[model samples]
Target: MKKNPQQTIPFNWPHMTGKELFYIAEAHFNGRLAGDGPFTKRCHAWLEERTGCSKALLTHSCTAALEMAALLLDIQPGDEVIMPSYTFVSTANAFVLRGGVPVFVDIREDTLNLDERLIEAAITPRTRAIAPVHYAGVACEMDAIMAIAHRHELKVVEDAAQGVMSTYKGRALGSIGHFGAYSFHETKNVISGEGGALLVNDPASAARAEVIREKGTDRSRFFRGEVDKYTWQEVGSSFLPGELIAAFLWAQFEEADRVTRQRLVSWERYHALLEPFERNGVLRRPIVPEGCVHNGHMYYILLSKDFDRQHLLDEFKRNDISSVFHYVPLHSSPAGLRYGRTHGGALDVTDTQSAALVRLPLWVGLTHAQQDRVVEVVGSLTR
Candidate 1:
């Protein structure tokens, strides 16, 4: 089979560590294909140790982890959770499912992250938590957000779905909040096909997080031989991934550092390649603030307002490139209008930044030649 030079470069390609199948076979040999098996425990230990969280629990998806966080927060009807509008719906849906309202805040212009400055303004008597999503694996202003949370007696759920292997001021991005949710979706820097984890930073909520993940039971205690039998105790659902998934993830965990390093190399290359276009005002490259270490999970360019973004996208398509836009501001979406409200009257930054943003093809194994072609297409089309 000959390679096609004209074939489109994909936006993402899941990386493998060459040990996935071997681990899966080992799991089968161990006779524990169920959740919380040996492989799952190993993954748990890795997450807890790497992130320095009190407890780490694997879940079927980041959405599940967030739902677990929502449950742990004990969000009641009419309660409010403040977060940015320029994020995945899961950031809001997780709370909406618990009958809580999502108060949408605008994003920061530079980092495209939740505006920690605006969070305090959105706080009200009904505010239960502040969910700051770490966009593009770049950390939000956790110190300020945490201080606000403390002042208002609010919880912080760091939506660090893209923050694995990334840090803020030397601390892991997800570890700074009261709770953190990470995604291991196929498109993420790390993959388990479709998986995630919950980081319980507060010890008081650690035990209940386990219960909520296990369908609201002290079944975790039972498994530890602390109880003779497991039984329903509170509000929870099945959030665990099977041993097969854990086995696959363990292979990725083994190579996590390598994966991050490779991705960073490619990210830096893109940064260098796009410098001229940025100077010419063709587009704005991503901004990584000082003290915030990112995992190179993404590389995006924000086009100027006058430029025709869709025209450039069509050109990329014709040129066999796979550049694409990011999220549509959730505050204006159908579900958002129905289940949430925009704070301070408008999400000006969120709407503008999301519309202009175009994510390039970034993945673990993206070649220099492929990246050149991708950028070449951008320059040809935009210039």
Candidate 2:
């Protein structure tokens, strides 16, 4: 079969385990489509077993999971949560919604993750927590971050939305923090259309985490026969996803290892292909520091200072190759201006990196030939 000359490669293609529809049908046959049903239990168990967190609860999205973290922390108006400016809006928005002030921190140059060294300086008397985002699946320096949090008696929420299956040292990215959140969104390596899970690492907070996920009720305990009746226990919202979403996510969890391996293969190929560009000072490839194992969640290139990122992206469009830029630093956004404050006076690294980075087409079934074409376009346009 001849391919269409104008066919465009998408920036992301959701992976399917072939059992998604089957499981969805099974959920229907079981006649339980509510939240925390059998499939939800299965997914929760799988996450707890794999990540070794004290508890796991599936949420509708990573944003929802983060919101649950905020509620669990009991964030009040005027309370501050420190985080990186170079991250998705949800990382800050979740806390901001709880009447909390998001204190924007700078990210490390190499990993583009929240710089642990600067976290201490951002803390104040009203500081409630530190939210570290694992950028592009590469982990933040959790050991240092945790030590600082411990010293300050503050909470740590790991935004591992892109860090699922990735690890820091020997520990899973999300498992190391007090609360870790995962995303199974269609854009993520593992897909359930739109899904996420919160990993509760602290035993003390597990029960409350469940209650918060269940709209501030003890409904989970009631169903588990732990309570005579479930009632509103605290301030919370409906964060849990329905049974059908869990059923779909269960299939992804079953094949999570395989999907991660395939994505790593693609990610490595991009690394090798982009090496020459990096060496020639045309572009820079991602840097994964030692002890950090990434899940190949994304492959993004940073154009050298002299090169125009938009120009190269336009070239990709002309060649029918889909390429895009990532987040605009949250500190610069309108909401951030209104609801947050920047720490350290200047976020030089975040501003520079966020501007130069561009993500290329990457997915489970992307071909070597297609990758070659991507590199070719990159080289032609940049050189």
Candidate 3:
């Protein structure tokens, strides 16, 4: 008889403690199932403290937070926003939906983040903002990017969906930019099934962001007793998340440090195990820039070449592991080609990096034995 294949390990899955149920039960008992309940307030407080952000507003998703950011910025027709070509569609879509042009730029090979050196070259007269995504929880060259933004007087919105409580040069990733977006989707480090938050670092932008998140209404102010009644005030949409989700999210936030530490340990183990391959030129491990403290949101390997990456992914699947490749450079994507500009610069680095990279199975509960097996399989493939 043939031997059975190893049990399928997921690429990622939410790791929940029983604490989430208690919070949900409390939400049910409180009878404020809508947005802006006690749990929502608690979640906001927790995030604000962790990120050192002036104000944080919970949204239905990171996508919603990003959309609200674009709206708050007043992005208008033909305006251009510079971002990386190697990110999720939502990063560019948020701006594009508001009739803004997405100016795609290449990423740096080391961190796979929007190349700060290339950003200056991409800015045109129409460029209004720089949206830097902290890919895989690694910090971008934020200081350089911010300096460029300051010189050009451009707004900086950080797409920090994968960065939560992660620090760069001792400052939180989300708090460094004018506006920042975070995700609590099931796939992220923390989960509320589907929830996210917007970080408003500038005090000037916080009031307007609160208004925009509450569907153009002064509801947040009204709830705070700033006004007797709430009414619509600006162009906005329903971006606030419900109380139950916030309650579930709060449970995770309460254990944020522990959870992050656990994930970091696993991340370090992988890095240690993979260093030999990296040194041998068979693979490249993630590079966390100096002065950056990441939350270990993801772990990926860049193979020596594209063909090796594909072969490795195929073998991982055959071995009952779920390894996967990431984003196709947006410049070459069908929708991006239609609505975005490529800055007319060479995207060789972006294309090559995307083709050669593969994300291994990583989640909060992934066991050491499972990780060892994954490493073994990858090592065999490369050898």
The estimated TM-scores of all candidates read 0.98, 0.97, 0.97
- Collision pairs in model 2: none
lDDT of 3 by residue, 1-383 (tens): 53323367778867896799999999999798999999999988888888889899999999999999999899999999999999999999999999999999888889999989988988899999999999999899899999999999999999999999688999888899999999999988888999999999999988999889888989988878999999999999999999999999989998888889889988999999999988888888999888988999999998886337767878888888988999988899998999999975669889988988889888877889989999998888655
Q: Which residue runs of candidate 1 sit more than 4 Å off their true CA positions?
A: 1-6
lDDT score for candidate 3 against the true structure:
0.90
Off by over 4 Å in 2: 1-6
| Model 3 alpha-carbon drift over 4 Å, by segment | 1-6
The whole-model lDDT of each prediction reads 0.93, 0.91, 0.90
Roughly what TM-score does model 1 have, to 2 decimal places? Answer: 0.98
Per-residue lDDT over 1-383 for candidate 1, one digit per residue giving the tens place of the 0 to 100 score: 74443366888878899999999999999898989999999999999999999999999999999999999999999999999999999999999998999999999999999998999989999999999999999999999999999999999999999999999999998899999999999999989999999999999999999899998999999989999999999989999999999999999999999999999999999999999999988999999999999999999999998788998899888977877998888999999999999999978998889889999999887888999998888887555
C-alpha displacement of 187 in model 3, angstroms?
A: 0.7
| Candidate 1 lDDT score relative to the true structure | 0.93
Cα shift from native, residue 207, model 1 (Å): 0.9
List the candidates ranked by TM-score, beginning with the highest: 1, 2, 3
Better of 2 and 3 by TM-score: 2
- What residue pairs clash in candidate 3, if any at all? none
